[model samples]
Structures are given as C-alpha cells and as structure tokens.
Target: MSGDLLATDIEAYLDAHEQKDLLRFITCGSVDDGKSTLIGRLLYESKLIFDDQLAALEADSKVSGTQGGDLDLALLVDGLAAEREQGITIDVAYRFFTTDRRKFIVADTPGHEQYTRNMVTGASTADVAVILVDARKGLLTQTRRHSYLVSLLGIKTVVLAVNKMDAVGYDQSVAAAIDADYRQFASGIGLDDVTVIPISALRGDNIIETGPNLSWYDGPTLLEYLETVEPVGAATGGPMRMPVQWVTRPDPSFRGFAGQLVAGSVAPGDAVRVLPGGQTSLVERIVTADGDLDVAVAGQSVTLTLADEIDVSRGDVLAAAAEPPAVADQFETSLVWMSDQPMLPGRPYLLKIGTRTVGVSIAQPKYKINVNTMEHTAARTLELNEIGVCNLNLDRAVPFDPYEVNRDMGGFIIIDRLTDVTLAAGMIHFALRRADNVHWQSVEVHKEARAAQAHQKPCVVWFTGLSGSGKSTIANLLEKRLFADGRRTYLLDGDNVRHGLNKDLGFTEADRVENIRRVAEVSKLMVDAGLIVLVSFISPFRAERRMARALLEEGEFVEVYVDTPLEVAESRDPKGLYRKARRGELVNFTGIDSPYEPPEDPEIRVDTTTMTPDEAADRVLRVLRERAILPSAGG
Candidate 1:
C-alpha cells in the first residue's frame, strides 16, 4: 500500500500521512543494549532513510563499525563524532518515521548510567517507553533504573524488548525467565501495562517481521504492536487549563492571552478563572494566526480574549471556573536529581512549572529510592542520578494538579538561581497540609510602624568570612558601638546560636545551609522589631547568603565581608579549627574540606590583614551611617 501510494498518488500519500496518529516514544536501557540499533532498524524497515543518509551510514559503518566487515546499523542513529568514536551513545538522538498505520518520533537515548538525566529529559514528553535489554545481560542495573524512571514519569505503556536473541540461540527458557523477573520488578514499581518480546536488532529477527529463529515465540512483531497499541490519551477530558505565555496586544482595542491549552477544551463564552489569583471572566474569543477560533482543545496554541478586562499576565493559568487547580506554596514531591552537585536542603533554587518560575527551596529528603530493590532508604541529600522524595517550599503560591492527574501542571524543574542551570526534575504528588493550614495573621504593628517609633530604620548587618577572619570580633565591636549610640542592636554569633537554636544541626553542607536558614529567619524577626540585627557566621555558600539577603527588603540587608587570607586565618587560628581541619579531625571545615564563597560585591569589605579589629568595626559603622541605617553623629 505504501509503495502504490508513493508511485501513483503523492497527494494521497501526503493526506494519509497527515491523518495518521503520532506516537512519541523513547528507547532506553543499559549501555551497549542495542537501543540505537533497534531505532535504526525501525527507520530502515519503515523506509524513512534518504539515499544520501543511507550512503553515509554504509560508508561510515565500514570505518567505525563494531561489527567487523558488516553493516553496523547503530551508525544510522549514533551521529555524534564522540558517540561514533566511543562506540556508545553520549547524547539523545531523535528520528522521525512513518509506517502505513502511524507516524512516530523516536528518541534514541544514551544507555550509560551517567546519561540517565538525558533519558529523563527525553521521556518527559513521551507517550511510550521502549526499554531495550541485551538478552545476554538480561535485567542489568540500568534496565531497572530506566524502568523505575519510566514508572515515575507516569508512562503507562512500556515495551520491554529483549534484544540479541540470536546471541542467546533463541532460548525460550532464558526469555521466559527474563520475562518473569522483569514482571516481578515492574509490578513492584507500579508498572502494570508492559509487553515483553525477544528480538535481535542486529539481525532484524522480530522487529519488523518474525524471523525463523523465533518460531517458539508467539507474539506480534515490534512494529505491529507499536502500530496497534493505543498511545496514552491527552488531557482533553480533564479540567481546562492554559498557562499564559504572553499577553498579545496588536492594536489599541485588542488584548488577548496567548498560550497552548494543556488540558480540556475552551470555547467562546466559556467561564474561565485566573489561577493563584482567582479572578473570574468569560472567554470572549479564541484567536489564532489563521483567524479566530470558535473552539480550542488541548494542545492547541491560541490567543484568548476575555469578556471583562482582568489582571491576567504571563505565568498565570486560565482554568475552568468550577474546576480550577489547587493553589499552594508547599508540596510533597518526587525529585530526580540531575546535577553533578548534590542537592542542598535549605538553599534557594528556582522552580519552573508551566510558564511560572518561583523561588523555591528543597527540604531534607524523606528517603531515596533504591531502583534495584525498590526500597526506601533514609537520605540526607540526593546525589547525581538519585531519585528521592522531598518537600518543596516555594516563596509564592502556584496552581497545580497531582502529576498523576495532569503532567503539565504538576511537573517542574529545579534551576540554580545563580547559574540558571537545571539541577533536578520533580513531580508533585500533592500539596502539603501545612500549605493550606498556615496563613499569615494580620498584624496591627508592622515593621514600618515599629521602625518609626524607634526613630531608626531596621536592617540586618550580615558579617560573613572564614572562621578565624574576625567576623565575630568585628560584629561584636560594631554592635557595641551601635548600642552606645542609643541604637537597639542584637548580635547573633554563630557559635552561640549553635549551642541553642542550631544545637541539633551539624557541619555537613546540608546542615550548614539549614543553620544559615534558621539564623536568617531569626534575624528577620529581630529586624521586624526595629532592631539592628548583626549576623556573624562562616556563611560559605553564596546560595544560602543570597537566601538570607532575599528575606529582607532592598537596602535592608547589608553584607559586610570580613576579608582575611586563608594563610593569615590559619596562623591566627583563634579556635584551632584550621589545625583540626588539616589533621582530618574536623570534616566539612570551610576553607579545608568544604568551600567558602566570598562575596563578589559587599557593602563593606574589612580586610583584617591590613587593619585592626577596631578599624574594621569603624569601617562598617561608617558604611552604615552612609546607608542611613543609623542617625548621623550630629543628630
């Protein structure tokens, strides 16, 4: 039928292709598991490769072929030079093909454990997961890891293709054993809909057609199943939701919200409500570039004009008035840590969900999942490629559904606030109960009123440096000077707070972040009471220091860097910490085992190597006066 359509009627072939359903799937498994070969075979069988591409694949196969003197089918998709030279996939390679029944977008992802994050990225939007396993190395570590990820990403359909049956001599018992083992593992990981098949991608045994070697196996070929199996349905039946990507205003009288509808459908006169704000209005028109649309369904990008002019903006969700998503500032979530740097609790990151990006921080992980055994082990932090359950706290409220209910609304990515690099991918399970129960109570006496009564502006003077760099000494002297000037001041020394407020915390990176978080909160409360709060600590990470600064308003948080060289601080060794760190007695000691990030731009820089403690304190006092935190000496 495909040959006749191409030979006789090009228009007919184009029409049939346009009407065919599209399936987006990913091929993932352990390294050298034939994921690329399987995709190449699929494209080859579908006749999607151009003549020039086929010539290149054939020529390159001889020079870089792992299969001596034979055509290396994996070269068809392993296009990267590094991938070809290493004989392994380093990045995801995508290919498009069409059969008589359907069209496909296949992602051939890297199978190495280090590239698991790349697999997650490819699987995020997939409708199916075709997890390949080398029949010789049945059910390896990455097979289980990818299987667990497939389940976590809410992929309902999975085809467990056991490849290289030709190598295993078409052993039915071996295939049966692997099937049983994978079924047990899949059941444990909540993967219910899975189909297992044995094939040799190198030889094209059971991919497009059943070969004579697999006479004992009675199942559809991989192509047959893929063409017939139903793809996961889109969210067209769920609550209507469209996150405003932009506000389109082309003319003086025209204003519309532009976005792709992620769920359900909308029509003219449909009542819609803006989320995280709860403003209601009726949809007046659905505008598209082609013209105005009377109706728009999920997955359609359109511009919507409302009957009433409301405060709808980008990052705001437009939803069905009666069935809007939940709004919360905290959520219980499952996180897949992707960065090489371990996830640090209490350190601020950015959470980007839908079109919205908000300031967010992760709490201590509840537990990390062991992909092999499916066990929940206690975890303090998540390292690279680790999956963990954690609670996320956001600075502002966001509207979302449970990931199981709506992928677009519930899925989010954690980005480094300073570098803007994505650190992790997370799926929301549900909003924490505390998010609903906790509310800020209205106060009669606010910070402005308290500051006015005290006759001075409130601020947090955060002193950060190496442990022996005179942060505490300079802060103490500065506090005494302020108090002598009739200023209400409170000094929070790091060591003093550790004995009381942070007694339970330790010296790990995660613990240090938490320590700074607690101290920052306490300082915020003190400043609210119209007092000058002096915070002295070895606040090493810039992320945590930035978190502390974000708690206060602009100009209300003054960073005073107490600068001293590591050698100078070690020689001073006021508390013998550097000696202990060098002797391996103290772990996670800043400037030794751990790290210390000096402020790039501080309000005041006090170099203790060049000045005495009194001079350092006097320099900070002068900066405070210039910033108007304290009254002038004449006043």
Candidate 2:
C-alpha cells in the first residue's frame, strides 16, 4: 500500500471484469439527443444485458407510457417515474456493466440548461466525457456548455459522439460537415483534444461494428473507442492527498485519522504530513471495513494510525512530506455561479476547500466570462451559472495548488451564507503576487524617526469626490505647501496612489470597496507613525468614509469633498473617462455609469470649478489647523 503499486494489480482488476478496459465512459447530451439510446445500444449490442433487464425495458416500453417508443431507451436508463415522466435526468443515474475486454460505469447526466450543475457533478470525476451531439443539428449551445465544463472539470479525453446519423440517411457528407463544424466550435472554446465519431445508436451502425453504409470514415467505432482510449490515472497518481473526513478517536481506544484518498497512493510506513499544521508522523497502519490492505490508491477510503501522537484532525489533509500545497488566509480563484442571488462585497459565505470549511467574502470579482463568447466583462456581481475570476478573502489558511496543477487541493465549493445552499464551484488561481516595489524596502530613516525629526505632527487630509473633480490637484498643492512650510508629510493622491499603491486593483463595485478598504488601512498605519497623510480618492461612499474615520484618532481623519456638480465633473473629463462612461463604453463609472454617493458632512467643501487648486488646498490645511491635528495655522 506504499507510494508505488505494481501496474499488474490495476490491469488484473480490469481483466477479471471480463471487459475491454478498467475505465467507464458516460454520454451526456440534451433531451431526445439519443443519450439513453446510445448507452442502451452499447449494452444491448455488447450482449451485457441480462434476460430480466431486457424484459423490464420491453415491459416498461409497451405499457404506452412514453410517446415515441416501441422501446424508448430513455425508459430503460431513467429509473425514477418522475424522471421518465419528465424525460430528463435530474440526478446521476449510474449503470454498471462489463464487456469481454473491459469494465464500465455509465453515469447518465441530464441534458437541460438548468441541470448543467448536475452535468458538472457527474463529469467531475469522470475519465472520459462522451458529449453527444445530434448529426442533423450539429453543435448547439449546450454542446459548447458541456465542452467548456468538461475542460473546467479536468476531463481532457473527450468523445464527440455524433448520434442520430440515421436521421441524415447515414450520409457521410452530412456527418463530415457536422463533424468539421463541431470540431471547429469545440476547438474555439478549449476543446482541442476532442475526437468526433459518427454513430447511429438507433440503427446500431458504428456502435459495435462498422456498417457498410458509412464507408468514408476509417476511425474507431464507439465500442472500439471505449475499449482502447487509455484511462487517465495520472491525476489519481499524484502526490498523496487525503482530505481528513474525520479524526476517529471514539472512546480514545485507538487514536486515528479517517479519510478518503482523493489523490495518489498511500501505504503503511510512508511518512505523512498533517497540513495547515505542518505536523509530521510515520504511518503506523492502514485500516478499513474490508480487513487490511497493504496499500491503498486514490479513490480508497481508509483510516490510519500514526507512530506518534499529534493534533491531526478533520479538514486537515494528509500528504507526502515532500510536496505540500500552498497554505494561506487568502487566494484568487475562478468561480461558476450556481445560485440565483448574485455575489456581493463584504458578504460572508462558507467556503469548502477540500474537506475544510471556513467563512469567506468575495473581496472582488476580477472579471465575468461570457459563456457564449468566452469574453470577460469587468464584473462586480456574478449572475447565475456565470463563470468569473474573483479574489476571495478566506478566514483560514488552506493547503492548495493551482487547479491546473493539483485537482484535490485547488477545487472548492462556496455555500450560501443565509440559505446554506452550495452557490459556486471554484478553482483556485494562486494568490496574486505582490508587484515588486523598488522603493518599498530601501529607506534613509525609519518612518517614526522621520516623524520625530519634524515634530509639527502628521495626519491625513482625506478628499472624497466624484471623478475629475480636482481631488488630485488639491492634494498635490496641499502637499507642496506643507513641504514648503517644513512640515513632515506625504501626498497619497487618488490617481498617484492608484498607479503606485493600488495598480494591482481595478474599478468594479467590489474593487471600489477594496480600494477604499486598502486606502483606509494604509492611512491608519501612516497616522500611527505620526506622518501627515494626504489622501484624495473618489471615496464615494460616505459610509465607507465614516468607517475610515472610525479607524482614525478622534480628529485624525479629514474629509474634503470637491463639490463640483455632476455636469461640471463630467465636462472636466480629466482622462476622457467620463465621456466613455456616458457612452456606456465603461461600466461602474462613478458619475454616469454608476451612482456616486457624496459625503453629507465633510471637514471642508471646495467647489473645484469655483476655486483655484491652491485655494482649495489652503482651505483643507486650514481645516486641519482648526481641528488641531496640525500644530498651528502659522507654525
């Protein structure tokens, strides 16, 4: 049961099944897309059906329950009455069988837009996805959908089984056109590895045998493809990853940890590391209900005892000490929205990473990917079934690698904060690397020492406004005057700070919230060191400004609103951004595209179009003097 296993064990298991191979493939397609029929044909022609299952299919078919059938294969596969009546696969109905050469596990996934979630569930752990497309219909939207989802699910080997070729009179020309179109569409949306096979489940041509009708094609038949396509055990054969399901210390008789081996192999005597806590121990023994196995590979559920006592608990992953995933409080990830409710800022949801569940807030939506075009819309809120990139702030650290690198640690689920429903399935995209600041570490003197050297006092001159309202100009002039007056200070202007301090960020609503959040935190830290901070931002939300004020000393925060009217601010067009916003070229724009909530009561109100930048700056400095945050008006 150690890290390495003899290849014969796997080969022998498949051989003993009396079938072609070890892996099973399931066909997922739309309703009346021949999903059930193709599966039925595979089993029927392969002669795997017992006398009773065939009898049940015939009996159920002849009752005149469904319209289009002497035998509607949908009836044979769809076990539930609800499913048969509705004619859709709601849940994953698994069917098992073995052929002369291999074993199979067919997970019949539903073919509806609403149940794409279920398709994801079925295909998540599948080896190969046989995405069926009707020959006459060519590639449809759901065809693109499932193809995209399979790429997301890490199912690389795909069989584009073109069914209902009989409808096109088994015409090779029509099949070829459909095949070319499908291949082109699939390739356009990350399905380059797909193989299109022409098959007619209804007629049984190219199913088990190559019929005389379609002689132009020389590729493997459906059964031939299933028997030969190598199963991907590579993912399952990675570094050991067992998400701790539970720590079995019942009655304390035998202190052990229990979990399923989500990836790789583990055996007794292998050194394992308990993650999020870096505790290392030697595996003492492996135990399961089915006696003891020397070793267990991926997909096995087993309990283990360590040679030494340690704090190994549920939600902790056990892995080989050499390769452990990243453990952090925060991570960037891609998400597919499943809930009707759109995500929001500062809203907490429970995040399930591997076996670990912790509260999380989507700090920001990086971009929303358009399903049809795969185009990304700069997103603040994600809608139902929409895929997007988001920055999630996790409450606890989790061991994870990028989804493309490691599946077990990288993938996660988000449960709704209120309803407790699973809202999204996410794949981590590694934490954002902080951009190197050439000036970050190098210093002539410490900030506190510099503040001590100039004793006049240090505080923030916060200017809140709508864009292009002279916030930056006023901030710059104020910093210049303070510099001339010999007061110790630095200007953290809106545009300058954005380009320098917050260049890693963007301008969505969530980005706006985070932009304010970050600016506030940095300003607070600056005030603590007694250095005057000049902050000018479109810190539009008065509530957020108030929160920032709450973080400061009683009089430390100064809010200066450049009260230029929306018409005037729009006319200024500091960067032609307003014009773009007006044209709908930009979304979440402060004045035109989005709401800009101004401050009700600011420390100072300077109408930018009415006053000079220097005058506005002087007025702001006067407010600081009046508040006694600065030493004196004439100091």
Candidate 3:
C-alpha cells in the first residue's frame, strides 16, 4: 500500500476507496500487551499516516518512547498526554485506513480490568476482535476477561494475535503452546472461531507481509485476515425493525418517522406493525434527503411514511407485520455494572434500549461470573467492572429480541435516574415467563371509590429525620389526632416494622435501601386503601426518598422534614444508639459513620428543638387541613 495513486489522481483514489466495504474491529488484551503498538503498526504499514504525523512521531519518540530512541510506533495511536506518559491505553482510540481490498476502522481499547467498561463500549459495535497477547507472559487474567467479553457481546469472529515474537526468538513452540491453552479455555466459553497468528508488532513481522523471521508459521497475515473477513454486524437480515428516533413534521401534510434500520429490508407497500401497540399499516414511502428509496436495508438511515396516520412516536418500533418482535415487561439479562457506585437492587433506573428509555429496576443478582475461573458465585450487588445475571422489571412492555438474535433490539444501558449517568450495560436473554403469566385482575371498586366511601382523600404522610429527632413520636401523636377527628389512619414506625417485616435486613447501605423500598411499597398500598398512612423512618439517602415520592400520584405524597441538629438528637439518644455507635458497637450508623442527606425541599419542616412533639403533630394537622387533605375545623 502506497500513496502514489493519491499524489497523481485524488478523484480516482476516492472512487477506489468508496467501492470498498468497511470492517470495524478492535484490538484488546491485558495491560502492556501492545494493543496500541499493533494498531499503530497497522496504520504505518497501510501508509495511512500523514507527513506531519510521521515527523511528530519521530520527534516525540525520543522523549516518551519505550523502545531505545527508535520511532515508537505506539506513539501514533496513543494520542492522550497521560496515555503517552503511562505507556498504556486509557480510552478507546479509533483510526481509519483503506486498502485496495477494503476500508477499515480499528479501535484500540484499554487492557486494565478497571477499564473493562471502556473496552465494552468499543467492542459493542465491532464485527471482529483482535486479542493481542504477550508471548513471554503467556496468558493473563485480563486476556481471559476480554475473551469472555468478546464472546458475551456476540462477536463471533476472533483473531488471537500473539505479539512480541522477537522477544522470544520467534519460537514456533511458544505460539503453539499459547494457542492450545487458549483453545481449551475458549471451548468452555463457546468461542468457536479463533485464528491464532504469531507476530512482532514493533518489528512488523507477520503483520503486513509475513516477514522472514516466522518461516515456520504458515497463516494469513494480520492485515490479510482483516481484509478478507466478512464485516457483518450483530444484526443483519432478520425481521425489519427501525426504532423511531424522531417524527419529521416539517408540514402537516408530510409526516414521517425517521430512524436507522437495524435489521431486514423495508419497501413501500410492505405491511408493517408499530410495536408494543401492534397497530398495522403499510409503508407509504421511504424518504431521504437525496431522494425517495424504493427499498432500504439494515444500516441505512431513512424516513418512513406510513400508508395511514397512526400513533407512532419516539421509543416505538416499526417492524415487519409477519415477524414482529416479542414485547414484555420483565426479562432475565446479563448486566455489566460500570459505575463506581455499587448497584442497589429495587432502586429505580432508566433503561435505554434502542431508541426507547423506560423505568426499570434490577433484582438481586442470581450470580456473578468469575471471568478467570468461570465460576458462578453468589453476589448481593455488582460493583464496578463486575458482571452478573439478574432479572429486571420494566414499567411497561417494550418490543425486543434476545441479544443472541439481534444486538440492536436486545442490548440496553442502565442509567441513574437522578444524575442521568450511565451506570451499566445489559443484554436481554429472554422475556421472563412470569411477565407473560402475571396480569392485573380488574376490580369493580378502585381507589377512587374506596376514598369516596371513606369521605376523605388518601395520602402517605412521610416523616423523615435523624434518629431520636421525634419522627416516630410526632407520627404517633399525629395519627391519634387524626383518628379522634373521624379520619381513618395507620402509623408505620421503623423499629416496629424491623421487628416483623424487615427482620432480615442489617445496617449496611444496601440493606437500608431495600428496607426503605419495602416500606414505600407498603405505604403505597395503605394509601390505596383510603386511609391516611403515616411513615416515620430515618431514610438516609436522598435517592431512596425520591424513589418513594415518585411512587405516588401528584399531591398524594406529603414529605415532612424534622429539622433537629445531629448533636441535639445525639444528646437525647432514646435507644442508646449514639452511645453504641461511638463505642464501635454499631457500624454504618447514620449521623455517626454513614451519611444522611436531608430533603432540600419538603412540604413541611418542624424544628423539633423549638417545638414540642405535640405541637409538631398539631402543625402537621393544620397543614393537612389547609391542603384539603382533611376537613377544616371551621367547616
């Protein structure tokens, strides 16, 4: 490959490049496995480096090169200052090159276990994965981890590039031993298609031209293998599916749904169904800026106009009527936790799959896979870079395929509800059987009828504060006052509930989250029964409090903040909790070791230091009367 054609005929070069198809691949392995070096060498051998880049490479190599002052090829792809200084890839670096046979997009992914999420982000779209290994180090933990991930992500083709052969005198036995060991492990992980090649990425041996050093090995060179392989993505010729990304309504007469087709082909007059609703229509036209397409296949972005006006919106899927995808509200999925915050089961998160984002909550993990040993160990929650299998419950049903069937429809990301940060990536295994079997039975009398008969509006009065801050005392007094005024009421104190419902839970952060979640659900049921439910608990985390608030209808959940100083509350430690915590008898105790995030905004705030518990109870009743939650005394 040379630039002689570029210098003489630029248009001819562009035409030649346009005709060739593209192959997206990633280079990944353990740290110091020369992933950047191999990609840099590939770019250099393909003649994709510009003149200025070559000059800079030569100049910068002396200052930061791992090799003794030679033109460090790794410097070409290591673009970050920290990457060059640390001699390891931290972020995914993508580069493009073109050969006569094909064009190529290569991503250099990080190798550290801490950056496994970064590697997953790069490999999610790749058609192939080139896993480099050090000949001297043999196989390491990260090598097995990335290999398992490659298989997990459904990249069927794998190239095991054994790098640094020159460091081992180009020994054929060294490469053979490593390949055999990997194959034995790969068999257990269902990795069937593996091509092993020996090469020195620094010396460009067996990478481009099969240098004479490896005379014993007879395999396709790294570049030759990449140029010939089929670059089919995870989903190709399946049922037609295009998740509507936008509704183009430039004018009322012209309405179309615009999105990229993830599978199969669509044409005008084809009967299509809008999913999760199953509304049938015919494709009126395939619109594009260039012109109208008579037919469009997967991987093409176009606007589709239906034969009839339908309720198609963003987050809805357009699919072939004959082979529509499955719709469900629950699924068993493989989850990769990417955030530093440990996953909390039953906590709400936004699940974004394809173009749709829905409310979802994960259950406790069934098991987490040990990437190195391939063992399934029990785990309560997933930490950063951990993989687990868990069940997820969605707020509503959505159309999807199994991850093995179609990546676009099956893969999804879990996002934090409040912060809007991506916390995990997940793949749907299949719809859970319970989701299909379970249905809400219709009732003759609903919550409104129950409330009307009781002659009052139902709500949950949530009282949250530090321990010994008068939450329980105020709630008890408030319930008695409401009862005397001819109102149905119930009180749920934290300690009393722990004696029965939450006996199994501990004082850890995860247990506290689950405890609040259970109480919140109970309170919701009590509210539906047409009674005023009082909840008094030291719910520490703000996120959990927000979760509880979201479970109720507008104006149905009232938050009362008991504003008592921690020192004052500690001085009146009614249960001796503060003294026990100070003596190291109670770990993860709020106001001492753990955190308590007070509500920034609440419906009512009572400073217990200035008011008595009876006065706080009376204040809550007065606010309730003003808000029309109860009948006013004047009326």
lDDT against the true structure, each candidate: 0.91, 0.78, 0.92
Residues 483-574, model 2: lDDT tens digits: 88777787776677788778877787656766787888899888766788888888876656766786677667777888989888888887
Q: Encode model 1's per-residue lDDT on 1-635: one tens digit a residue.
A: 97799899999989988889888899999999999888888888888888998898888888998888577889999999999899999898888988899888999988888898999999999889999888888899999999999989988789999999999899998889899999988998888888999999999999988989999989999999999888564435788999999998889899999999999999999999999999999999999989998799998899999999899989999999999999999999999999999999989999999999999999999999988778999999999999999999999999999998989999999999889999999999999998567779989999999887776789999999998999999999998898888888899999999999999999988889999999999999999999999999999988888889989999999999999999999999988988998999999999988989999998889899899999999999998888888866555
User: Distance (Å) between predicted and true CA of 116, model 3?
Assistant: 0.9
Q: What is the lDDT of candidate 2?
A: 0.78
Q: Looking at candidate 3, what is the lDDT of residue 210?
A: 90
- Ordered by TM-score, highest first, the candidates read 3, 1, 2
Superposed model 2: Cα runs more than 4 Å off = 1-15, 18-24, 46-56, 62-69, 79-91, 232-235, 250-253, 434-635
Candidate 1: regions farther than 4 A off: 7-9, 232-235, 632-635
Write out the backbone clash pairs for model 3: none
lDDT of 1: 0.91
Q: Write the per-residue lDDT of candidate 3 for residues 1-635, one digit (tens) a residue.
A: 32677789998888877878878999999999899899889889888798999999988999999889998999988899999888989999999888889888899999989999999999999999999999999999999999999989988888999999999999999999999998888888988888999999999999998978998988899999998987444447988999999999999799999999999999999999999899999999999999999999999999999989889999999999999999999999999999999999988889999999999989999999999888999998999999999999999999999998899999999999889999999999999988657779988888889887777789999999999999999999999988988888889999999999999998888889999999999999989898899999999988888899999999999999999999999999999999999999999999999999999999999999999999999999999988888855454
How does model 3 score by TM-score? Answer: 0.97
Q: TM per model?
A: 0.96, 0.66, 0.97
Best by TM-score: 3
Residue 542 of model 3 has an lDDT of: 85
On TM-score, who's better, 1 or 3? 3
